[model samples]
Target: MQDITDVAKRLVQHNKGKITEVYFVACGGSLVDMYVSDYFIRSESTTITSGWYTANEFVHATPKRLGKNSVVIACSHGGNTPETVEAARIAKAAGAQTVGLTYNDKADLLAVSDYSFLYEWGDETRVHNNPMAIMLELTVGMVNELEGYDHYNTFMEGMKLIDTIVASAEKQVEPRAKAFADAYKDEEMFYVMASGASYGHAYGFSICSLMEMQWLDATAVHTGEFFHGPLEITDENTPFILAMGLGRTRELDERVLKFLKRYAKKIEVVDAKELGLDMIDDSVSEYFNPVLFYSVLSKYRYALSKVHNHDLDVRRYMGKVEY
Candidate 1:
């Protein structure tokens, strides 16, 4: 967590002069890209653009957009995907400097790019992409060429909270997770509500485990949007995990908890405080919570992967998509 934080801060510092913009590209799991884009916009004087496509769309329609002044960070968990590699190759061909994000030093996302940073995690667990997602967000700050931020100790202090939460949750959430997973484990679908920092949490949880592990269409939603109209989709039978947060918006925390209790099938609170997760309440900037949450909250994914008897790495067997 701290390492990635430093990477982000460093990127911002290093690229301060040559570029005035940044781009995040991904195919399917592009939530991480969005998080980084938000960070760049908030912290620097650069235009942050996020674009997504299936590998083929990117290859056929957008791959030519890269250039020397462009610093492209392309991501894939396995690094072996045909499209990510193809995309990176295209970027290189078009004279764009590229970096690959992955967990494996030898994967294609790394192989095709000029430099790659493998996230410091070893599990494929339930959500193999957690590390990648969080790392991308953490590293984004560095890529933006911004200066004067002290994030290393700050981010780890936040991650410490996550570590604390999981250590306690290892004992506390099992029954809850098992009960929820078993009850909806066989069900066809569910929903996830994520607001603020937890949006990244919900994004990873829904896509990697709730949807991928169970083969359900778990969703990530913003609470404001939920109240607008999507709230109609909530029901007594729809299992939900509300990604409660203790970030900049305490109001969101209150609203999410209240709504989940009344409408969600089985409401789970990721009370960043009560879980006994080691967290630094004061030092963290909320935009970076995904780094901490995944480092700690992600244990649940590993636990579920074990419960389902799946391999440690989901992508080892589950290829990106079918032809």
Candidate 2:
């Protein structure tokens, strides 16, 4: 596999000053994975605009600005998601530079994209090579090349610790994860909450882990938007899972935690600060919080699958039925 940074460098070099916008398009968990990149580019890049879109919607309502000056990063784990493939094709047709990330070398998404990256999966020691990490590297690489990020080396240093961080966090959260699964096995629904970079973790856990895998109803609520509407659903018996991050927006998660502690009896928090987020420099710690949060919370989902007697791989309609 080509080095992700090298891939990013080539892409940025090819476009240089001509690139003005980036669009991230995917579906399901892949779409959720794009959240961090979308957030990072918007926060770091002054010259570039970014958008995150569900693949199907992106196809139906292609952006007017998606032309020669645009770069579209599309992902599919297996590289065969129809909408994502179509989205990549459309972006290519519109003269936008397309980048595809997938775990499969033979993925259809690679055909339409100008650059292709194969991210590592199912390997604990190679956690740094996961899809999200690859996207982060690509984003940071682009920003560093375009506008010069002072903390670029810090970000690179943090990547080396990803495997250790994920392993340590998984070990630390194991007991809590087992306890949570035992306690919540009978629960019918859950509300997951987080803010900033960690929000994508919440969204993926809610939809992919709980709803799709366990057949339980789940909703992901943004901590910043909780009081506006979602807080009304909270009560002593309501089950809630909160992912807290150590980022600039940590205050938003703190506020939600305070409220949840006050009124919600069933609350579980996966805090990045508690899971060794300090191992990375403060300047770039927030960008890595999602990785820590996702790794630890995955333990909970595994335990839940066991206690609920629902195999995580079991699905009713996905891939087996037409929508």
Over the stretch 1-323, how does candidate 1's per-residue lDDT look in tens digits?
Answer: 23555555444444444544345556555435345344434553334433434455668887444566566667776677777788788877876667677766778677677656665445333222355445444544453334334554565455444544445555676576665545554556666666665575677677876566645577787765777887787788766666555556546767866886876656666555555433454445454445445544455555556566664455533656665
In candidate 1, which residue ranges exceed 4 Å CA deviation?
1-16, 27-57, 61-66, 123-130, 133-145, 150-153, 156-171, 263-265, 276-278, 283-285, 292-322
Q: 165-254, model 2: which lDDT tens digit per residue?
A: 888888999999999999989999999999988888899999998999999999999999999999998899999999989879999999
lDDT of each: 0.57, 0.89
Compute the lDDT of residue 80 as modeled in candidate 1.
Answer: 71
Misplaced by over 4 Å in model 2 are 123-125
Output the number of the TM-score-best candidate: 2
In candidate 2, the residue pairs with backbone N, CA or C atoms under 3 Å apart (3 or more residues apart, or in different chains) clash, namely: none
Where does the lowest 10-residue lDDT sum fall in candidate 2?
120-129
